[model samples]
Target: MDQTVSTVIDEDVCIGCGMCVKVCPVGTISMKEGRAAVTGKWSLNCGHCEAVCPVDAVRVMSLDKEQSAFGTFDADHRWLPHGEYDTVQLVRLMSSRRSCRNFKDEPVDRPLLEDLVKIGVTAPSGTNSQRWSFTILPTRHAVIGLAEKVGGFYLRLNRLAEKSWLRFLLRMVGKRDLEDYYHTYYEYVEEGLMEWKQKGRDRLFHGAHAAIVLGSKPGATLPKEDALLAAQNMLLAAHAMGLGTCLIGMAVEAMKRDRSIARFLGIPDKEQTFAIIALGLPDEEYQSTAGRKLVVPRYFEG
Candidate 1:
């Protein structure tokens, strides 16, 4: 973790109220001679001090200000305090964001995709590593190109699963992955592949005009979780932007099982992909929010 302090406090603007010192997670800022100063050697560069400052005197050089600026919409730069947002509308948006399988033939603009990536990075990361990477397939042609690669991978996998002797041999060595995949997904994948090849139907991406592949570079403390959190942000933001989104887990699995797929997508060897989001203008609509299965909450008194 690169924790070298990039925080600088303007003495003239700082009121020395000690809020920055109080909120510094790594103790990077401390009150010295009645004025807050950057006395620590290391910091998380999370901009907590900057956000908490009453006088806007603190600045985190490692953080990018342009990330908050959006091209598609005007963003409110002022921070919203806790419990200030409308919870009903928030829940409504969450409930309305379903996995869309039907997308229009229209293509998504590059600026919207770029703005979505910006929304993604707003998610919290472990230790503020912020190592997440986004690879955008901005056009239908690019999306189809990646989909073909994923479909090919599944085609090869189906072939291996078709070999009963190979499945048994792998199971004999205490590896049941092949057998389990054969039992669980063989038939479904076979149908999808058939639809893709014979009918030219896109079962992989569901005819989405654009896609975003989310990944994390090496050395992230919690890469998968970080990527997933960012993915959820993108999903919700996409829905709000009048676009439909679906998570293509099969594509993620393909990249995980076959490194060549990632290489084909121009991702580096060390970077690990966590999610693939297929998105475009929706061709389908619903009347109401769907219901979820009920679950009981548990309390941990300890």
Candidate 2:
């Protein structure tokens, strides 16, 4: 990649503690006599050298100085004081989170939505590349418009899936890769969507006060994974704020397939919504947690 790493050592400020060498995940830093130096031919560019320096003697040329972590380890500005007790509380909070479909008509305040987005964007990303973007559909009308477009797209797909002759024609025309989506649309048309329509409710968004569309740039490495992490973070934070959240996988899929729906959401042509979270005050409540089958991990010891 022709990327050169510039490492500078302050001879006078260095205490020869060798802390930087020990903390470096990649073996890029080495002790030359009494001072530290970059001995490796290539750097992973993880920025551990600068983080471990006791006296700030090392500087990575490729790193942005403004974005670098500030403050000492003992008094790090980013450290939060919660520990095991907080972990238990967090677990309880997550266990109580429900995928709320029924929402009160009250709108989520702009300040709360802003706070949720702020927490969401702070989620960890590959190489610290926070490329996630969010589009907040705050009004009922806007959210309904998006839901209608996605529902229409699915309805059209359902027609082709329902007719035997049309399905055969579609397969012959080099479009036989939609079996899974076709099934989903078929079920939606048969029962799931009709139930909502009978109750005069929005089938897609479930009459949520607002919907947050989480997206990332097309072709980005780990885009789906990154967006999922951010969505989870937003969910937990929303629950904490006395709000409900539901991940709308159907709407996300429709957005990916239909460019018109994507444009309606104001998402860029090259960007895609990996996930959508509907947020609002809950219309229903649960007194206790429900039981479900658990899948335990298979651990390996080497």
* Top-TM-score candidate index: 1
TM-score for candidate 1, please give it. Answer: 0.98
Model 2 misplaced regions, further than 4 Å: 1-85, 169-184, 190-199, 299-302
lDDT of each: 0.94, 0.77
Cα RMSD for candidates in order: 0.9, 5.0
lDDT of 2 by residue, 9-77 (tens): 677788888987887756677888887777876665656677777687877776664343322112233
TM-score of 2: 0.76
Output the worst ten-in-a-row residue range by lDDT, candidate 2. Answer: 68-77
lDDT per residue as tens, model 1, 1-302: 67889999999998889999888888999998888999999999999999999999999999888889999999987889899999999999999999999999999988999999999999999998998999999999999999889989998999999999999999999999999999999999999989988998998899999999999998789999999999999999999999999999999999999999999989999999999999999999999999999988999999
Q: List the pairs of residues colliding in candidate 2.
A: none
What's the residue-level lDDT of 108 in candidate 2? 80
